[model samples]
Target: MPSIARVPSVPAPGDAAELRARARGALLGLAVGDALGAPAENLKPSEIRARWGRITGYVTDRPSGTDDTEYAIFSGLLLARHGSALTPAHAEAAWHAWIADRAEGQFRGAGFSERGTLENLRRGLAAPISAQHRHAWSDGLAMRAAPFGVFAAGRPAEAARLVAIDGSVSHDGEGIYGGQAVAAGVAAAMAGAPPITVVASALAVVPDDSWTARSLRRAVAVAHRGERAVRSAVVIGGYPWTDLAPEAVALAFGAYAAADGDFKEAVLTAVNMGRDADTTAAVAGALAGATQGESAIPEEWAAPIGPARGSCLPSMAGHHVLDVADLLTPEVEEGVALVPGTDLEPATDLVRETDPLRHNAWPPPDPTVFVLAPDQDEVRP
Candidate 1:
């Protein structure tokens, strides 16, 4: 556990260096907040305060992140590899190749939604069918959404679209909405949007009447009153599980709103609120970190974050968040579109020459041409 250090203010944005810093801050903050909030995950606020007085820093002697951080790294690597063309097929294949089919390591701690998705995949189910589980509305997707925001910097709609594609393999309904809100919020923050605009960006992506939207509105509405008030406004006290997407996303945004996007204050506010603490804090951390840039995080907190241990996903063992940040922060060329599985899209003439079907044919081709194709199934009649 590290002691709290003086937090720095956010610097001006608009350069590659600043983007990199914000990317680093977003991921490092997620890990830090995950580790900080792990011990308080499902406890009530009273229980958390009773156990650790106010919890200003890491509470355990050997603090480490949980499923939230590792899963975020997993999604980050997938996004880095595929970029804009990322599809549900790509995400599903990665889940099987990197996680579901593995047989070596212990399938340690993970959220119910992840376990459910893995079970469905092992049973030969595919997404979005694979996502039809009992806990489909869990915050599992939200926990791993920040990387999409990092990859689609300044493009909130693109971030929401990409994260939903990733979430289809594991979640649905409010779960998908929750992921969208977090990803959009981070994307706006990456572009140096103010806290109010960031929250608005999040709300704009989801349906206006959705559970996630409603809870988010309620939480932010009361955020000025503090964590207790925010918690009261959004949390469903009778619910047993604390990982509801609506509740968790609301709490996280509430914390961010309450602190006005200050990295340390936002993360701590989420942590102290108690229910689904790890995930709420992780989302809050990502938002605040993006808004404030990496320099805003306390050195004591950042120094302890390292390569993920892969307790939750063995394939992510040696990759660090900083490594992901580097992969996502490359310089963009002015008018060249980047392609997946390669560096850049080929010139128009080159594409036409290489791919005959890519260009428009002058006159309309025979309508029956497809009916005479050689590969058609033999017609016994």
Candidate 2:
């Protein structure tokens, strides 16, 4: 099992309190989007109403984000508790525990990318992590890159690079690039920057070697011109499972650009547009949640997005947006031991920090609680 060794989490230069607050905002942004966008995943405004009759509650299906947001949060919590990121190995160990216990870890049964990745990891197949796991390319990367951005606030390049490796574990091509772009945005948010700049920064890091990047650039270009959704998607070729990362990324960008910096509006716009509803929500959710903060999510729409605060769903990943941010506070940075494990000759491990395009990480992380199935006694609305 690949191992994520412990390393120092250096804070960006700023008033420590202010930095902590921004970190919280970024973290909250992910959860709120994951929750809010989830309910609107599959249906457009019309279909959503036709099917669910006016989606005022948390839409469990869409915001599910195939568990992207949850997994990202889970990684962060593990890092917070253990004080470093997980190597592929550590992540695998966590998965094994889940399988053994029927724990159904966070986003475990979501879809193709995760399923394939886990199977390969379980077999101890030591291959370099790359787009190979889900060779066809998928939206898995787009959803889970936010937490990495938050944790890697000061190192945008590092964040982008690291997330790409993470993405390769279950994604490839445009899918991996999507994770890179999203992580870039989160890093920008963590740095207390504007969304446009963050998104633009992300646009730059994605490789120019493919059509997805072109599509992403086109989407960004037209985001300000008009209703970016219809124009960008149709003109720029947005469609679910089309092997197009930019389309989804663009839709998210257009919604973000059109919504007057409102998290709710951005997510609503994406959900209302249709196709890849959940993944779109997952991507848009991570971006918007980073910008707007958890408070921006409506109370009425909050419940079905997933579980609420204080719930114990092992599969849901341990922390909600709120819990995640709280973990990054200025006060939380004291003697948390910047390292993750007991001891790895820091001298040797430190030198191996260059980010890999993918990972074949081993050693397996401790089991993570993907969702905490609620008990009947506490099932009140």
Candidate 3:
């Protein structure tokens, strides 16, 4: 019933202030969308209310993550501690740290399907992954991948490398590509590029020959084609009701296409598209948030997207959310190495010749939160 032309507006100018605002806005968008859809996971938006009832408002109190959001937040925490470093040794330390935390029940509340991560941690079977089918390879890797893209804005490839590492622990192939594609979108958005161009950069890393790539490729095509695009995706992209990945991508395509470059429309369109609505909405919202910032998220939705339980950023208190740019300071102490979360062994030889300097990586000042035994919270929150 909505006009297909209702696209969200991009932020004003490309000033650092604007860019930072947009980045924080995107993070908020990611959290909002993530939390909104939390109650609906595998259900269709329609079935969601029946199954879990209306989510009403911030059901959790602060933002808590399923695997997608958790992995991304974890990646951010890793980067925050190390500044901008990505060395193999650092990578190993990170994973070892994550494993130790698991032993201590740091991630005890980790979601259902994500229990696989715990399995991997228990057995130490995860391999060093750079590309394709590295591990679990599920959509979770792609779900919260936008932040990395924002962190590596202006450096799409750098963004991809970070994605490769973060994803190596749990995703592979099209799964990784999904994360890469989304990350590229965020990076380009932060860099102030148009949707058309941002998507193109994302495609460069997403295998143009695969299912994920095919969906995105077709989505771009539909953005210009309209109803026919929808038809193409349903026929080729598959329905989300069948599974979250395909159906989610289909809705993402329609939302992105219809929004043109508008973040709100992009998200709403995805939400309205039905199955996996929450995640589809989140993906579209993140891309849009990256493009437009907090301003792009309609004021109507902002009020309710606050202080949920399990939120990593407890400062949000009980009912608050950060806008874009607020996430950026050019000043968060960028270098600190606490416990590492992912394995660096396999990527060792491959990364040594190409590891980015290890600059940001640290544990939360809340040592009580994670399971890192030997790791004490050196800094206070």
Candidate 4:
């Protein structure tokens, strides 16, 4: 087992409300991005352009999140119940209880990674062995990683650790790295870190030599150049699956970096890039939202995002992102009055001080070719 860092203490009462709002922004932004990008998922950029012409807003008449939002809800509720003590066993059990053990009708909008995991579980396989399916490296884990960041608040390392625990039940290698990057980025954003710092926090958690890290570095390096450059830098051309963990995670972070943490631009950039649009946009939305807070999200964009309809996980039905945010945020004690001018302590006091980008070498190593998943006719939504 990897040595874990100390978990940060919960925020002070004055900061609690602020943290809660950011958490709400992170989760709500995820749902909004997921819905807005759903219509563009699996389509090529040209196809998306032909159909919706840049997807400035929802393309569908009644826009709603697909598997992305529901999976985040599933992870959020599980994190709420377990807190920082979550383990691989707990995650596996939850899969069995809330997913695999349920009737066939209950499993509706699950992505390939999830469906594969459920099948393996029903066949009596336990994780990380159960995670051996072909699509184990999909962006499924990355899509749900924001909740760990929301729960850990300013603690990026701890957030990464917790998300890895969650991912262990269904992902491996680049898949786990993808989730770690997203979680760490969101955690840094929650701490009010700048966009560069947030990206650095993401790079800190995973091996620098991994495909996910390499692609992320490439994407962020050219992010300022423009969205097209960033997408072209990271996307693996000719890969059949749009949900490749390394490519999607890089594109999402690149979008966030390109927009400088602006919620709308970050999500819209990701959505228009087209590959795994829902997951990438959801990740970008979560990072930007955590940084900017709920009020930063456009009112009209926020309006359509109601409680999740359990399109993917039936056990998560009727649970709104706000509800999960509230659950993840620690509440102030009753009757405890907050000092109006109380200076909130810096997060450095709670978390260990370490160079987040120690492993990031300038001019990232030459890109390495990886084995792509076997081409399948059905792409994950």
lDDT of 3 at 171: 61
RMSD of each: 12.9, 11.0, 12.1, 12.4
Error of 2 at 326 (Å): 2.6
Backbone clashes in model 4, listed as residue pairs: none
lDDT of 4 by residue, 42-109 (tens): 88889988987778988777888777898898888777655666778989888877778776334453
Predicted structure 3, TM vs. truth: 0.67
- Model 2: residues >4 Å from true position, as ranges? 1-14, 44-46, 49-66, 81-86, 92-108, 127-136, 225-231, 234-244, 292-295, 299-318, 329-381
User: What TM-score number comes out for model 2?
Assistant: 0.69
Q: Please, what are the lDDT tens digits per residue for candidate 1 over residues 1-381?
A: 111111222222236578788898898889888988999999988898799879999878878888899899889877765667678998998888778887524544388999899999999999999999999999999999998887766777778889999999999999999999999898888878889888988998898888898999988988899998999888887779899999999999999999999999999999999989999999999999999989999998888788888888877776788777766665445543322222532222211222222135411242111010010000100
Q: Of the candidates numbered 1 and 2, which has the greater lDDT value?
A: 1
Question: Model 3 over residues 1-381: C-alpha lDDT tens digits?
Answer: 111111222333335466667677777677666655555555544565565454434445543433334445545545433434554445445555543233433445243224565455456554443222323445566675776666666556656667667766656665667777777677777767777777776766666566766666666666665533543454323332323343355456557767886876676556444455456667777778877877877665676554433333221123222421232223222232222232111211111222123333222233112211110001100
* lDDT per model vs. reference: 0.81, 0.53, 0.52, 0.80
Residue 273 lDDT (model 3): 42
User: What digit string (tens of lDDT, one per residue) describes model 2 on residues 45-114?
Assistant: 5676677664444555443323645666555544443333446555444444433234454445465666
lDDT of 1: 0.81
**What residue runs in model 3 are displaced by over 4 Å at the alpha carbon?**
1-14, 44-68, 87-100, 103-113, 129-135, 224-250, 311-381
Ranked by lDDT, top first: 1, 4, 2, 3
**Please, what is the TM-score per model?**
0.84, 0.69, 0.67, 0.85
* Candidate 4 C-alpha error for residue 273, in Å: 0.3
Question: How many collisions between residues are there in candidate 1?
Answer: 0
